[model samples]
Target: MTTATIAKPWYREFWPWFLMAGPFLAMVGCFITIYFAFTQFSNQPIQEEGLVKRGLVIEQQGAGAARQAAVQSKP
Candidate 1:
C-alpha cells in the first residue's frame, strides 16, 4: 500500500512559518545588538583612576548630606 500526501494551498503554506519565526529572529538580532553595545561600553578605557575615585567620593558626600538633611528634618 502507498500513501500520498495532500499539498497545502500557497497562501496557507509558508506565511504562518514566517509570522512565527519573525519575532524570534528579531529578538535574537536585538540581543546581538545589545551585546555589542555593552561590549563597546566595556571597551572604552577609563583614562584617569583619580577621576573615578573622585566621582565615588562625590557620591558618598552627597549621600552623607542627604542623611544630615533627614536628621535635621525630624522634630
Candidate 2:
C-alpha cells in the first residue's frame, strides 16, 4: 500500500525564514549604520589648526624625552 505525503509551502516552512533572518537583519543594520554615518558624522567640520598644534606639542614632548635620555646616557 502507498500513502500520499503532503508538503508545506515555502513561506510556511520554518527553515527558510530562519536562514533568511540573518541576512535580512544584517541588511537592516547596514542601512541604519549608513544613515547614522551620513546624518551624525558628515556634518562635523575638521579642525586643521588644532590638529597642527597637537602635533607640535607631541613633537616637543618627544624631543624633551630624547634630550633627557641623552643626558642620562652621557654619564
Compute each candidate's TM-score over C-alphas.
0.35, 0.57
Highest-TM-score candidate:
2
- What tens-digit string does per-residue lDDT give for candidate 2 at 6-71? 998999999999999999999999999999999997765544533323323522245567789999
Model 1 lDDT per residue over 11-75, tens place: 78888888879899999999999999888776553445233333335222445677899999999
Residue 36 deviation, candidate 1, in Å? 0.8
Provide the lowest-lDDT 10-residue window in model 2.
Answer: 51-60
In candidate 2, which residue ranges exceed 4 Å CA deviation?
45-75
Judged by lDDT, which candidate is best? 2
lDDT of 1 at 62: 49
Q: Which stretches of candidate 1 lie over 4 Å from their true place?
A: 1-12, 43-75
RMSD of 2: 8.5
Colliding residue pairs in candidate 1: none
